[model samples]
Each structure stands twice: as structure tokens, then as C-alpha cells.
Target: MLWTITIACLLLAGLIFRQSFRKRNEEIEMAGDAGLAILEFGRAFPGEAIRAVISTANGRTVFLRLHDGKAGCMNAHGHHYSCHLIEPGMVHVTGAGPKRLNVKFSNAAFEGGMFEFRDEKEAAEVSLWLLGSFMPGLAAQNPRIVGQPG
Candidate 1:
């Protein structure tokens, strides 16, 4: 009777452990997929149109450039993503390295940390988006408003 009880307890514990491990792995896998990130963000904010997506090297964060000259980010929090549309004066960014940036958010709920991009250009591009100075195709259309603050 003692042997059977011990084996049952061990089996239960193993099952619990396996479930927890699987949940964590699922979160990691979801975080790595840019399409999933974009889908989640879109679900959260259906009105926003995303122009470009920049996934970090750690696969935990995805930065988005909106079609209307806005910036946004999706951060993985456990099984769900915390999506935020970055407004003007809401964020501050500084370069940590050629391919890394230190982001600070005005909102206390949003945690800021070091974001490492895939390359220097991506890092620079995100920085420009955060700074509210990145308007690629829009700039060519309106040369008079170039360098003007929104």
C-alpha cells in the first residue's frame, strides 16, 4: 500500500511539472513568432494599421510602426501580450549599443528595459519611431512639413 501511494504521488508531481514546463515553452514560442505578436496586437487594437514590425533578439518584445505615423509595442507577459500604442511624449529612448536601446516609458504600468534589435539599422529605426521623427514615405509626400514637430 505504501509503495503504491508513493508512486501515485510521484506521478502526479511529474504531471504537474510537465504541464507547467509546457505552458512556459508555449509562451516562449509565441513570443518568437512575429505574426502571432501582430495578431495579438491587432486584436487588442483593431483600428491601428501596422506598417512594419521589429522583433527583438530575445524574442520577448515586438515593436511596431503604424501607417499613421505612430509607434507601438507588444510585450509578452506570461500567456498574453501587453500591447500599447506609443503616443507623442510617452516614451524616451537611448542607444545602449549599435544594436541595443534602453527604453523608458512614462506610464508606470509599462515596464521599460533594454531592447536588443536584430541589427543597427533596426535599432536606429525603432529609435526614430519612438522619437516621433520617423516618417518615411510620408516625408516625401509633404516636404514642407519635414522636420516639423507633430
Candidate 2:
């Protein structure tokens, strides 16, 4: 009876391990796809670093990160994405979300000229990071703070 109990426990542990491994693989695949989407947006290769992903209220995903100091944006939908480089004076905060942010860009490459993030703090951080990476003081001057009354 003890041997049977031990075997059952081992089986349960194996199942848990398998499930965890599968979940991790799925996440890695998603990140890889996001990196590829960022590249398709015409920036440099993401090079294995995906800083953050923000979900939009409209069911899109916005990926924000820096590649060797240059900022990149990839608005992804499934396997396809709209991407571009974030530049100072090129990005503008158009509005705020309950826990999200809305933004427009001067870059002609981004067709709709706008993107949204589900997490307000992430929105603020990404925007400031992009701005600070380029124009330095402009990010500080920007009045858009996530979770704050805009």
C-alpha cells in the first residue's frame, strides 16, 4: 500500500512538471513571436530582450522595449503586428485609461497613429522611457501619468 501511494504521488508530480513545462514553452513562444513582430516593424532585431507587454482594451497587445538604447514599439494582433521606432516629438499622449494609456505618434509608419495599453503604470513607464531615451527632459515635462487624473 505504501508503494502504491508513492507511485501515485510520483505520477502527480510528473503531471505537474509536464504542465509547467508546457506553460513555460508557450510563454517563450509568445515572446519570440513578439520579438519577430517588433523586427517586422522595421527596427533593429530585438536580440532576446522583451521588456514589457501591455494589453489594450480593444484586444491588441503593445510591446515596448529598448534595443541598445533605441526604443521600439510593436502593436501586435495574433501573429501579425504594426511596429515602429519611438522618437521624441514623434509620440504624444492623447488620453488616459482607468488603468491604461492612449497615445498617438507622428511617425507615418504607424497607420492609425494611436496605441493603447491596459496597465496605466506600464503606459506611463514605457512612454517616459521612450521619451527620456531620446529627448531627455521632455519625458519629465509630459503631463501624462498613468493612474493619475489627466
The 10-residue segment with the lowest total lDDT in model 1? 132-141
Against the true structure, what is each candidate's TM-score?
Answer: 0.73, 0.48
What would the per-residue lDDT of candidate 2 be over residues 96-127, giving only the tens digit for each residue? 55554456666677644445555677667666
Best by TM-score: 1
- Weakest 10 consecutive residues of candidate 2 by summed lDDT: 139-148
Off by over 4 Å in 1: 1-25, 133-150
Give the lDDT of residue 134 in candidate 2.
Answer: 66
User: Which parts of model 2 are misplaced by more than 4 Å?
Assistant: 1-59, 67-69, 112-116, 133-150
lDDT of 2 at 31: 45
Clashing residue pairs in all predictions, respectively, total 0, 1
